[model samples]
Structures are given as structure tokens and as C-alpha cells.
Target: MSATPSWQAADGCVHTGPLLQSVNGFDVVACEACGFSHTLPLPTPQELEHIYSHEYYTQEKPLYIERYLEDKAWWDEVYAERYERLEAELPAGRRRLLDIGSGPGLFLAAGRERGWNVMGVEPSERASSYSREVLKLDVRSMFLNEETAPTLGQFDVVNLGEVLEHLPDPAGMLRLVHGLLAPGGMLVALVPNDFNPFQRVLNESMGVAPWWVAPPHHLNYFDTDTLPRLVQRCGFEVRHVETTFPIDLFLLMGHNYIGNDTLGRQAHAMRKTLEMNLRAGGETGRALKSRLHRAFAGLGLGREVLAFARKIDDSPSPA
Candidate 1:
């Protein structure tokens, strides 16, 4: 196969740069300026469009939707936490929420139940239809960009759940999200925590390849430090950075589930079981899990990083 073309880094530097390694047919390189690793020769718009719309939930996982719905109880706990945080931080009376890249409208459903006026922009026909028809959510079946931002108008909160890493130009996408927000509006983004210390330990110490690094489908890699920096540069002030469960902990505990399909499925089921047990224990278990999540986030060991930021008001300060 032919080599892919190089692209400029977030710092605007254009050089061949240093190759970190290769994974799944893509060259992974470390950005000299920002110190974050990204996949080279970012996938084209058409390629990404087809992947997300047609193959993401089907070809990629095959059982993703089924698994997601099966784990709704555990996922709902996560959604509730997110809603509570946003509700507390955001100014009252500004409940307009726009969930960019909302898949199946789970979060939007959570927001609506919280009394927020919620809408979503999803690219997948299957997901969008499910969101609208099944959940009765107000979701536009399209991607969110400069041209589409105007029609959506301003929102008090804009969410990008598990969406940033898929983009070739994540910085550009954040700038668009900045435009979608009202003054003092919040931005919540969740991306895979690739290149983190825990992941490095998995690769270097445990003799496992970097299985977390997927390309084309996931073009950008961000960890705790780099994710917030990228958001700040895009005109949002960072508010909170937290993490979900570090499933890699299973590997550390002698369960090598990465490549083994049966083991991997068991690991997922174990996660759901643990969460369900904790949730059933009521407030005490919930509090303990919250603390554990915060601790994992502090160590930068979670599988995904959740960032909350607010759009900066650039209007001149009162003279």
C-alpha cells in the first residue's frame, strides 16, 4: 500500500517529525510541539462519513448497540453524574443543550428528563432514527459544522461524547463547538485516553501491543494534559477533567482480555456487574465509585477523559 501524506500539527509546524510507532496500518507520530501522538494521513471526509454512517455500529463492533442497551443501567449512572455536574455548574434558566455527535440519544434522553431543552446532531441514519423514533428526541440527521451551527443557534451546553478522536482536525472542530455555545456556555468532550501512562505500562511492561490505538476511525489521540490544552487553545476555559473506569486494571490484575474475544467480552460483563452491584448498594456505593473515578482521573489512568469547558467571552472588558 502507498504511504499516507503528512499533515501539520496543532502548533502549525509542518515537518516529517518523529514516528512513535505503527498500529493497525497507520503511522503514529508524536507532535513535536504539543507532545501528543496522532495518526498520520488523516482519513478523508468521505471515508469518515461512510465509516461512521455505515460501518461504525455495525461492522466495527457488530454488537455495540446491543451491548450498549444491555448495559443501560450502568450507563445511566454515568449519565446521571454528568447531568448533575452540568446542572450545578451552569447558570440557571439556560437549559438549552446541543449534543453533537449524539449516538442513539442516550445522553439527550438523560438531559430531557432533567428538564433541559435538548437537541442533537447525529450523522448515522440508524442512530438518528433510533433516537428520534424510539426515544422521541429532536435530533437532526447530519454532522455539526460551521454551516450547520447557525441553524442550531446558541446553546447553553454543547456535548461531544466520544467524538473528538475521530476527527482529522480536532482543533477546528472545537472552534466550531465554541461558536455553537452561548456566552458562559459549557462544552463537555469525551475522548479515548490514548498514550497515557497506564497504557504505556500495558505496552512496555506487560508485553502487549498498543491495542487501544486505532486509526482512521480514531485519528487523534489525547490524554489528560493534551485534551485540556487543545480545548483551552480553542477559546474555552477548562473547568473539570475526569475519567471513567480504567478497565485496563483488569489486565494489571492478571486478566489479559485485550486480544482474546471471550476474555474481552467477560471483562465488559464484569464491568457491568461491578457497576450494578455498587449501584444496588445505594448512595454509599455510588459515593465510593465516585471517589474511585476521581482517583483514577487524578492518576490519568482511565480509559476515557471527560473535559468540561466554558466558552470564553471575548467582548472587551468594560472600559
Candidate 2:
């Protein structure tokens, strides 16, 4: 722990909290007001624009798109689960969806397959182009902001998967989303569950660096507890919060994949196999697997947190 730094949030709140760790010269500290940790000295908006728009998929994470396609089967299953949750919450006829930071648009494509009017907002030109030209999906190649949001119109559900953690102002982004949704519209937000108990065990016992503290890319670090609170603060009523498998358990078990890409792939494959096997093992196995994941979430011991929330009815009418 080091000296806490004074930081200001998007909502004008000042935070000077305990230092968590430093990565790439960026200090991550818990926000005294928001209760979540974020990288200090936030990257400028222009820096973020250049990074995500041009370099994210091409340079920073070159294998991201390829790996996504490689694991298409599992990814489809994951997307299906999200849609099932959204469908369960929304009315039968309500199938309009807007996926913020839609990435390669596989999730939107999945929604379209299920009869939903799906649209996406992605900043990356390469990803957006692939979604439109190759996948033939309607996607806007721009960041979601005040100007861009008004043009997309309203949606019955807004899926913010793996998007919030990258933003400099997560709560502000959610407030924008609150206005984009119809009354009682669902919001499916998925983020990496950093600083969980499993991660602590790995860091303390195994003496591993805080590998998840990625700067310039992941500015905010959130867990199940902090995420739900942030969503509620942005005018949404949380309905459910569940977590995915705790993959860090493998790292604790001596399969250290910190810098080893081959080992990392193996660990990911093992996790996928566990879930896919349960899914393929008939209805009873699927039910059991779902229950197991819920239990993990309850204990706050998962690799990712998937929260479902609905816009509070008292929200202003969409413009």
C-alpha cells in the first residue's frame, strides 16, 4: 500500500482512498465515494479514443478476434444465456436490443437469431466493419456519447458486456444507458470480477503480481458487490447477479499462465470444457451447473460478474 491519491469521479465526487497496487506506472486505488477501485491519473479521452478505435483489436489484443472466433461454440452458449435472462425479464413482444461496445457483434447476431431487433455501437473500425460487412449486422462504428446515443433511439434491453471496465467514467456511461432504455428495460452488464477471494489467494499465497490490473485498457476494477451498487446508482434496479467459473483457481493450483500464452490457452480450454460438459450432460447437469455458478456468485468467488438490472420506472422519458 502507498499514499492515496486524490481523484475525481465523473459525477464530481472526490475520492482519496487506499492504494491497491501499481501497474505500468499507473496506481490503482479504491474510490472512497464509489467503493470500487480504478486506475489513478485517468487516461485522456483522446488517448482512449486512439487506443480503442485503432489499436485495441489490431495491436493491443491481436488474438482477441481470432480467439473469439475459435471459441464460437462456447461464446454462442454464453450469449444465449444472456438473451434468456433478458427475455425472461422483458415482455413477450419486447425484443429490441442495443449492445453498447458490441465488439465483434456476435452477441447482436445471436439476438437477431432469436427474433430481436438488434443494433450495436462499437468504436473499433475493424470490429464494426466485420460486424456489418461480414456478419451483415447493423452496427455503428463510433463510441457511445451524447451525440451518438440520441441517434440510436431506444431499446428494450442494453447489453454492456466487457465495456464498463474500460471506460473512464462507468457511472456516467450507465446514466446514458438509463435514458436509452424503455421503461423497465433490462440491462445486462458483464465485467471481470477482479480482487475476488480467489485472486487474493493467488496473489498472497502464490506471490503473483496483480495481473488483472491492466491500465489504459481496464481503468475500473469491479466485483459483484461494487458493480451492482454502481448500476443502482445509475437508476437501475438490480434483478440478479451471477458469476462465471473461477479460472484463477487453476493458477492457484500451479498452472501459472501469467506470461505463457500456451498455458493460458490450456487453462481457458479447461474452463470451457467444464461448462460445456455440464451443458451437454442433459437437463439435470445444466441445472446443476447453473446452481453451482450462482453459488460461486453468492460467495463472490468468480472470474466474471454478470449482473441483470432494469431501468427504474421513475426515469425520464427517452428523447
Which residue segments of model 2 deviate by more than 4 Å?
8-12, 315-319
lDDT of 2 by residue, 1-319 (tens): 4588876756566877898888898888898866798988788788899999889999988888788899999988888877887888888899999999988899999999999999999999988998999899999999999788899999999999999999888887998899898888999999999999988877888788888989989999999899999888788889999999998888878899889999999999999999989988888988898899889999998999999998998964332
TM-score of each: 0.90, 0.95
Candidate 2: residue pairs that collide = none
Ten residues in sequence with the least summed lDDT for candidate 2: 310-319
Instruction: List model 1 lDDT by residue over 1-319, tens digit each.
Output: 2333356645566624477668777787776544466877666777888898888876787776677787787788789888888988887798999999898888899888889999999988888898999999999999777688889888999999989889876777888888778899999999998877877887888788888778878887888888998888788889988887788888888899877979987888888788777767788997887787778888888889999998888933211
lDDT of 2 at 37: 89
- Write down the lDDT of every candidate, Cα atoms only: 0.82, 0.88
Report each candidate's C-alpha RMSD, comma-separated, in the order given. Answer: 3.7, 2.1
